[model samples]
Target: MLPVDAMITNQEKLNSLATECAFHRFSIAEIQAATRNFHNDLVIGKGGFGKVYKGRINGTRDTTRRIVAIKRLDSFSMQGAAEFMTEIEMLTKVRHSNLVSLIGYYFDDNEMILVYEYITNGTIEHHLRKADAPLSWMHRLKISIGAAEGLNYLHTGVGNQQGVVHRDVKSSNILLDENWVAKIADFGLSKFIDQQTSGVSTRLKGTFGYLDPEYYMTGRLTRKSDVYSFGVVLFELLTGRRAVDTSFREEEWNLAKWAEKCVKERRLDQIIDSHIKAQISPKCLKEFVQIATRCLKSCRKKRPTMAGVVLALQQSMALQEQYDSSPQSASFTHIVQHLFSGSRLNSVVSTSASAPVTPIPHRFSSPPVTPSPHRFSMSPKLDKIDPVHLTLNLVARATQNFSPSLKLGEGGFGTVYKAELPEGQLFAVKRAKKEHFEALRSEFRSEVKLLAKIDHRNLMKLLGSIDNGNEHLIITEYVPNGTLRGHLDGAHGSVLDFCQRLEICIDIAHGLTYLHIYAEKKIIHGDIKSSNILLTERFRAKVSDFGFARLGDAETDGAQVVNKVRGTLGYLDPEYMRTHQLTPKIDVYSFGVLLIEILTGRRPIQSKRSPDEKVTLRWAFGKYIEGDIMDLVDPQMKESLDIEIIEKIFELAFQCAAPTRADRPDMKVVGEQLWAIRMDYIRNGRRG
Candidate 1:
């Protein structure tokens, strides 16, 4: 919201500031005549700032008239006044190719208007979702790169060694000209800081879904916030979705959160808009996702500088160019096969701004199926892999006595090593030193008992245990891909895809639900996070490491008790953390946090988040209230998401993470809900 600079209360001070700022001044009557006395027909756009009218003013000397956009502030908006002053101040001293150019200003006792050169083509947002024609991939890349360069200039190119952070960066703020060039506009929320000084802490203010979690939590508006917002715009270009789409469910209301899940889960193909997905090469897609993801990191220090972001995007653009002309690329017919649907080819995309753009169907919704809670699946057959005791020598022979080369990864409990058994079969051996036998023994006992009793497609299968009083080891069928944490941590070099991630989630829910009800005894998995969830080569999720698990009697709420609570901090149940009551509710709460992690691509405990913002659910809950939960979604998962289904998962996750334990749904119900979500997505062609 910005007003005309000349409309300040102190006329003398305004005049002085204008003289010092070096901007042209205009007469109030001249402006009134140009806009036809602010006629409604002349009005071109309306927003929070107020009405904007298209006008033609006489040139300084020539007979030719200049077409301009005149913006008038709403008297009720104090924010508009502040923005006007800042825009006047900033636009005068700083200049760049990618930013909108200010022409002159007019103000008097009852009238205030700022004139800017008219941008003929309108906003990037307009060409994106509102315009009749969809922007091609090259156009999308061009606009994004231009916007990034402009932002880079603002952050560092401003004279006097100052830093300018564009607090509100979105598609609508990026104006496009007749040539389709990008021009960043709206300096209302911009902040200027000295290069030598640290950032100033101020009140948090930004549009929903585009706001930085770190800035919103700490009130520290750094350059990284702009980078985060730019990253969101990049997502918009990639997904062909809005930053905050209300038509979507609450969880998907914010595109960033949903996209992050797609990137982390390696499901970019499933979420990207179909129109542009083919235009990008897989390599460029990876590079682009990497840069966007880096920019959206919760920690400011972790996010790349605008300059770095620009460089990375340039590299991605180069990669796209390589894809365009490469002989190895797919033939035109192959790519064209996916360009249009059977009947959409006949539809013409209109270009009239007054008329609404026909939206291409992104994803379709299916009838939701809610399964009965009474249904339960028993362990298929434990006889397939019974708990066997192998000698230490045999375990050592398979793993070469814990060779470093064969080591898969190390966890809190023990180190996992890949082993080739005598039968030439691959297996993962979890081992601990003799010194930590007591703790390892307890974990081993719990895992053996629970895993031995249960057998399900989604549950991790235990093969044999070796305990010769020295080096203890537990053997299980080897998974080549490693854990979900490994993929999330970027150690695997590739992420699980969207469909795979959802499938994994369904698999986990099935396993957890089985343990909660179908097992010989109802069990509570005290700890459920990404690391504990193993992944197969196909990215199938298998519930592993039941060290903190316990037998729970669902019949009696207080039947199970614990002297001390044991669980991950952010994933830990708040009520369970306080009451120390070991119940199925605790497992439900932990699973809820896991669901958030899966959806948001964030760690359970974000160390860099502000003190009060330690938990992802808390931040998510706040955005949920603000009605832009999609902001928490990943940037990679763009157009492919089913809006309604994403909201259901988020609602389910929130309910699972509810502060009140009694409000949490049972694991059986959780499993059914997750199944329903997957089925819904499948119906929407998620697998395709």
Candidate 2:
């Protein structure tokens, strides 16, 4: 029996956990009501630790009832209180569609219970073993991909939290929903891993058949162990047999070992489940078998990480989909003929291919008689090929012969001019400078290509372009309120409120998040600074300047070697500058500088300031450490500031600008954090 003090400490920890997680805490009365006084009829499933009861619980905010699975602890269960608490802690911190969600919990009157979003269907184990019909090839692929994604999310940190290793991974724990969507459940044996830590030291704890061979030999548990177990599950899916079946021959008892041997012998077809044997595409099966076998390698180092497993699984799925979508020779010939039709080519070419824009009739019959301060020497080849081809004469006339008064701003690419057509339609035209025309032509085309694929409210919109042999110009929607730098400098003749600044920061975060993760192709917005962010009349931010952007994958090592670093000096990532490695984190680091600038109303660098305050990040960080960061807040906005919001923003800024890429959170997390801060500010400010 534990001492009184030990019992009190455990209770205190539980109280803290209840407060930290956002899950609803249920009263014992509510639990009994939901489960009908623990009726035997409601018991849907039973396990070593508890019986899962399908229960109806009315939501706190609404009258609508929610069906949930309530797992109640048994008196003689194998799992004790510690395992229960661990499961609660793990589920609350990480959230992803592929992972089971914890709805609420009850731990009153010596009764420990967990409530989960009820999966309509049952466990993958059930379908694999006792179901009336075998899972189809497509269904199996979808389930495996979803399960792999959930494991990947656990192995790699989600949002602001560090990664959690789901120590117990098997087909039994992978639950399927009504739509056949896979959700990884059973986090009782999970462990959280910090960024610097490779693995944790712990006593061996896993099912016999699904245990990692290396982990079994050595008690040290790592993410690779989870991968090994997931590999065993894959083989179970592959062979439609239990992980360890004594009825099978001795060599075939262990699924992982048997599968590995079959793969090595190139005789995997012998064990392929007859149901999916003919359905599986040769290429997909080959890739699937290779990745699964690699996961079962005895050496932990040789085992693929969960993330690698996910990528491989996704690739295999894609291959299978392509095979499914392939047409016969006769159908393929017809498809080619249909694709070459003139109307289809014209409509699809604008977005999918580079088709020269059909030139519109010029609003003005002739060019302006007077040459403005900004002059564009006309190119000889005016109608040269490119997407969104605007006639040179129409653009030149719209901008009043590139008038100095109409010019909005200038960057490495060229000067931007606000153009107004006769119909009063406004557009921002970016005309390449004469001296750098030849050098920047390709860059101009790349930017056009990148912008064509982009479609986000927070990102600048691409209207059209003009590319003659000598002159190159890109057009976009005109943002009337001007750049963020202008507002920060008070060029707008109004001081921005604290709330407005916070909104602007959130908008920028949204834009960056989309660029880094949600775009059709992942992009690194190589340059991010106050000047690059343009504001709409309502103070909404639209991130512009894709001249230096690069197309890259965000999921791999996330680093690419660059011949030369390109970005505004003060906002450039220090690590990128020092090592010449480019990644999405550079934009994150730049955004950190922008955040500090927004709060302090100071430029990233102030040469005239004293040595201590010359660099805003350095000085702001020092003040942050001293708990006097409020001293640096913009004086005009200080009156409406919430201390908590200020601290959180500054804290996030510093985290983004941390010395190494590993220390920085991804843009998606940063966006979520900013939104949370905004909500907190709105709530707390009202209270004040």
lDDT score, candidate 1: 0.71
Residue pairs with colliding backbones in model 2 are none
Evaluated against the true structure, the overall lDDT of model 2 is: 0.76
Q: Which residue segments of model 1 deviate by more than 4 Å?
A: 1-10, 326-688
Q: Which stretches of candidate 2 lie over 4 Å from their true place?
A: 1-6, 76-79, 159-161, 326-688
Q: Cα RMSD to native, each candidate?
A: 24.9, 17.8
Model 1 agreement with the true structure over 140-211: per-residue lDDT tens digits: 877888899899789867867588988999988899888888999888778898654547798887788889
lDDT of each: 0.71, 0.76
Q: Count clashing residue pairs per candidate.
A: 22, 0
Tens digits of per-residue lDDT for model 2, 32-116: 9998999999998887668999999988567888999999988523246777888988887888999999988876436778999
Give the distance in Å from residue 557's predicted Cα in candidate 1 to where it truly belongs.
82
